[model samples]
Target: MSSTQLRANDPQIPSSADGSQGLPLLVLGALGVVYGDIGTSPLYAFREALHAAGSPSVSFARLEVLGLLSLIVWALTMVVTIKYVSFVLKADNKGEGGTLSLTALARESFRGRPVWILVLGVIGASLFIGDAIITPAISVLSAVEGLEVVAPTLAEWVVTITVAIILALFLVQRFGTERVASIFGPITALWFLALGVSGLVHIVEQPSVLAAVNPYYGVRFLVVHAEIAIPVLGAVFLAVTGAEALYVDLGHFGRKPIVVAWFAIVFPCLLLNYFGQGAYVLTNPVSEHPFFEMQADWTQLPMVILATAATVIASQAVISGAYSLIRQAMHLNLLPRFHVRHTSETQSGQIYMPQINTLLLICVVVLIISFRSSSALSAAYGIAVTGEMLITAALLFVVMRRIWQWSLLFALLVIIPLAIIDVGFFVANVAKFAHGGWVPVVIALSAAFLMQTWMAGRRLLISKTRADEIPLRTVIESLTKKQPLTVPGTAVFLTSDVEGAPTALLHSLKHYKVLHEKNVILSVVTSSSPFVADNDKIFYESFTPHFSRVIITFGYMETPNVPRALVLAKKLGWKFDIMSTSFFLSRRTLIPAAKGGMPFWQDRIFVALAQNASSATDYFRLPTGRVVELGIQTTI
Candidate 1:
């Protein structure tokens, strides 16, 4: 059976939960988390366009500046405002949004399992991870580079300071950010306010720059200078790089808050800044640093400090988003489980994953040391963002047709234009392959390979393991007749396959030759929905005198506590006491056989991953003293 089919048959759906606070607070939170990446883009996006335009003998005239500004404004309007806020956010899966959530929702629209859709989802997730790594390195590098404007002598210290700051950021992750997180929203709001005030000052000087809001300037520039514009489009593409964060972080902040924050604060501030930069550039033809040049000398240092803080905030959001994405992937069996720590008492979304944080920090440091400047890193940035956007557009098309059940013509009307624009951005970025763009492509391809291998290897391992095990019913009947020595306390055997006798139970029966006074077979299931109803969380059935079966279901978004779930069994007339119950778990040691499911090399990779997976004792929050792990060797 397909993964989607298995999920469909797993559990019951719960009522949608509205986790929103008041509208004002929700918008404040959205500004900090959802808008950080895109909000900080004004720091380098316009500068990069100017650099791209001036290179290779292209003239960056006043009309060219206007054209680029118009393009920037319209791209934000089309990609972020219309596509994400107006359409994609409305297609959430049980009030949750992201590629995986959307993938699960889209899978339900079709009658049969579609492997292609699953592959698309995997590719999109891999690309997002690639962006996560690049975002920190580039954002920090760009922000710290602002020091050069304040003191030319400090240019030499930019990379060192950036690396130090990044190291500190990752190191503090273990302690959690709950204490300082409250300030992120207010700080980002102030940053946006500063951006608008700074830009409006310059924009009033050159009123003609406001004419760029006309979309005609954007189309005319592209048509007139198609050759120059084609390459510039790659640089222009940077303006909307973080557009995907809106949908990726939809679950953390509800739709209403994000939409309100975008229309009210983020969109207007970005346009004003971009227009301000354009206006400054038009009057001073020879100036390269228009962003800092327009700022008065007294405010320049403060602007740099605020820009650095904003970029740090943006990097934090990307890191947190990665944790959420990988957690979902683990629940879906695409990757092995890592240690997940809930940092906040009231907020379940505030999570810390040490392994992910460490790996990302190492990669970000390497990128900073190698690239050395934001200009070089910028070449590596757009490709991953555009590729992810393309995949999202493809998935969105399927969602519009299959889930929303729109007419063919209507779906085409909405998605075709987006597909064309996304494709244009992606094709433009293809030129970056020779100039450091290969970094994210390589990272994304490696991630995709690992996910596919792990998923395929899991299926094979489960099939092989199940082939060797007997039915639970058969074992129970024989045990009842034979009547082994009865222990005093209750025993719970954790199993992936509820139909068959658990490997741990079989080992316990074969070696110890003892059955407890009360034997409960427990199976834990993860569903595709965000949350399962409490009423449908547990199911129980009695087979023999002392034997029974219980199943507990948890949503992908929740952390499972096995013993706590068992406490609910009292409602069904089963006397349950955590002190009296001993949990039995199977610890599989995979051995690669010549005639096994996967190729020998891939099997080795799977084995390495399995060996590194977090122990179930910690994952399920089971008691350390009462749990017994019986190890078994399995050929796969």
Candidate 2:
């Protein structure tokens, strides 16, 4: 089987045919994409923890530096290395990985209906969107804040420069990640190298910082300084903020490349830098930006410029991840269909969504303006990152117990400690509710509501439509017995239920009083896997001499193009002609009812979402001129 057809939930790790040949390149690409978010954390993560450690009684000293460094080191080891790389990465859905992808897998594996699992998936995806906005704002702001260190006089231009950089980053997304991907690997490689070198320089001066690797300082600090541990965790969680991205981008780089990249280069560099910062902090107790201060005076300006570039690249990973996530949401019926434009001809996953891009840009810009500084934005960051991680750990337990067929004891044994750790971080971040933490919580709740409403609204629409729907067999038999005025061309009515008469077909018969010479009831299904084989793409069932039910299957990661897929109909003796085909669609105008299943406000939200959703004609790549949409009002 081709690599794309490999199931993500498959027990074994997939090996690419060219895996050995391109091992180095794949590792490089993985570094650029998978590691971008966590890689850039060194810019502000250590600094933020320092700020968080500031209590009235606490002072910047060797103990504090060692304790914070230990916390960061262990956080990375537990969160990224052990939890994600070793465990969560193993849970894939047909070679695909992400919150929604794994959610679908676990949901399917459950013996009975598991609605709560769906809620978990939506919340994970929503908080990811929250992370999407904040990563760019905080990353760019922190990177640009280096200017304050380079030239104290340029401090006032920081926000403006940050905004300009963010705008440019979002503007170029249309060209796709492929266009800018080549430079990402080398730049990030150099960034990590610089991180190690700079930290190495300071560690030589105060080699005692190396002792933080023992993890004893980390545990001791939390125990001894129990009073401020909560706030400290919120900042310490920053060390592994982008750890989920490792699992989210699993499809792009595969399991081996990502895991290999993390241990071999990414993990070690991050450790060195965090420890180096600890060493620097011990000497310069009152330093504002210790990361920049760790470098030599002459290299400070160049490091600032490099950091800015790295932050932009970091933002790209989050943006592209959001696109992948929303596309999955749409496929699984949790969201309205949006236009997904393929930017690279060679790679199917290299897609861009204009609506998501614009929305994210606006949110990021507003955040930069509102917070005006990275330190302020930092208060909003940990909540989403930790919340998403907690959700992932929850889903991981489900995958183990249900999908992986592990015993309950085995599952609990694995997840309990991870849960305790995740819950600790989540609780710590939650304490920041008054300090901008509500920003992400609010965004997550809003997004989860929209997803739930969309799914519920679609179910209601389908249920209501089925009330009046006739079996296609009955329609075909009736048409054969009493032939209506037959037209020359073919008519294709798209419907969700292939067995039932399409609403558009029923409407067409009542108004036009005619049937086409050839009629096809078409239903397109999204499979759970990432790609479907061509041989199994189309399934055809002929109901009568001139009537047929056609079903086309597309993997969640693949686009559904009707004209291209319909070409396969010729194999079943159905001559296909796009010019002679007339596509029929049913557009429902949903009206909120006082006694509907959902809340009245949610019903209204569903109505608005359905109204603005992309049309079936454009989504299915139907010929615009030959398409007709029949509108129907439904009270639900």
Candidate 3:
């Protein structure tokens, strides 16, 4: 059966929970977390676009500056405002939004699961990881590079300072961000205010640059300079790099707060900053760092300090996002289980994954040392963002047609243009493959390959075990005829297959020659939804007087606690006592056969991943002293 089918009931679209906290505070929180990445783009996006247009000389043509500004303005309008904030945010599944959430929603709309849809989700998620790694490297690097503007001699120290700052950021993740997060909203709001004030000053000085608001200038430039359009478009995409964060963070801030923040604060500040940079370039075309150069001399140092803080907040958001994404992937069976630590008692979303944190730190450091400058790293940035956007567009199309039940013509009208824009940006970024684009490409492909291998190996192992095991009914019938010695305590044997007797239970019967009075054949299932209500969390069935089957379900976004979920069984008349209950689990040792299942290399990868997976006792939050493990050998 499909993952969505495991859900007990169809998911309900609930209202946002922001009412208790008040809209103003939620909006502030949204500004800090949701808008951090895109908010900081003005630091380097415009300058990079100018460089792509071959404007390295002292004076740039008015057409080039105006055209690039126009493109930035309209891209933000079409991509972020219309597509994501207005439309995509509404596609939340059970008040959660992400690639997998949307994928689950789309899967539920059909009677049968579609492999193509799952592939799209996997690709989107994998590319998101690539974006996660590059975002921190480039954001922090770009912000630190501002030092070069304040003192030319300090340019040599940029990379060293950036590495130190990044290392510090990752190291502190174990402590959790609950306390630090409270200040994030205020600091980021101040940063945006600074951006607006700085840009407004320049815009008033050179009011003529405001003409770039006209989309005609952008389109005309692209057509007129078709030869350089590809590279320029690639650079232009940097402005909208963090747009996906809007939808990814929908569950945290809700639709209204994020939308209000964007329209009221973020959108205007970003536009003003981009326009300010254009104005600064128009008069003093030789200025290399338009963002830092446009500022007053007295404010330059403070701007650098503020920019560094904002970029750190941005990096924090991406790192947190990676943790959430990998957790979802693990629960959905797309990846192996990793150790998940809850950093906050109040907030369920505040989780820390050591494995992910260490991986990101290493990747970000390598990218900083290899690329050296934000301008060089810019080449690697757009491809992952564009690819992820394209996949989101594809999934959005399916959702519009199947779930929303929009007419074919209407869905086409809405998605076709957006798809075309995505394709254009993707193709433009692909032209940058040789420069630095291959970094994210390689990262994404490796991630996708690992997920595929795990999934395939799991299916093979299940098939092999199913072929060898006896059905649960047969085992029960045999036990009924000649029952073994009955113990007083309860025994819960966990298994993936509800139809077959658990391997642990079979081994116990074979070796111990006894059965517990109250035996529970427990199975844990992960649904496609983000959070499951307590009412539908457990399903229980009795096959005999002593043998019962219990299924506990958890949402993909949740951390499964089998013992806690089992407590809910009391409501169904099952008297449960933790002290008298013994949890039984089968620990398999996978041996690869020389033949059928997967290629030799993939078998090795899957085996390594399995070996590294967290123990079921800890993952299920079971009492260590009350758990018993049975070791078994399996080959595929």
Better of 1 and 3 by lDDT: 3
Give the candidates in order of lDDT, highest first: 3, 2, 1
Q: Model 1, 125-192: lDDT tens per residue?
A: 99999999999999888989888888989999999999999999899888788887899999999999
lDDT of each: 0.86, 0.86, 0.91
lDDT of 3 by residue, 486-538 (tens): 99999999999989989999999999999999999999999988888876788
lDDT of model 1 at position 354? 87
TM-score of each: 0.96, 0.94, 0.97
Worst 10 residues of 3 by lDDT: 1-10
Tens-place lDDT per residue, model 2, 173-246, is 89888877889999989988989899989999999899998888889899988999998999999889889988
Report the lDDT of model 3 for residue 461.
Answer: 91
Please give the lDDT score for candidate 2.
Answer: 0.86
- Weakest ten-residue segment in model 2 by summed lDDT: 1-10
The TM-score measured for candidate 1 stands at: 0.96
lDDT of 3: 0.91
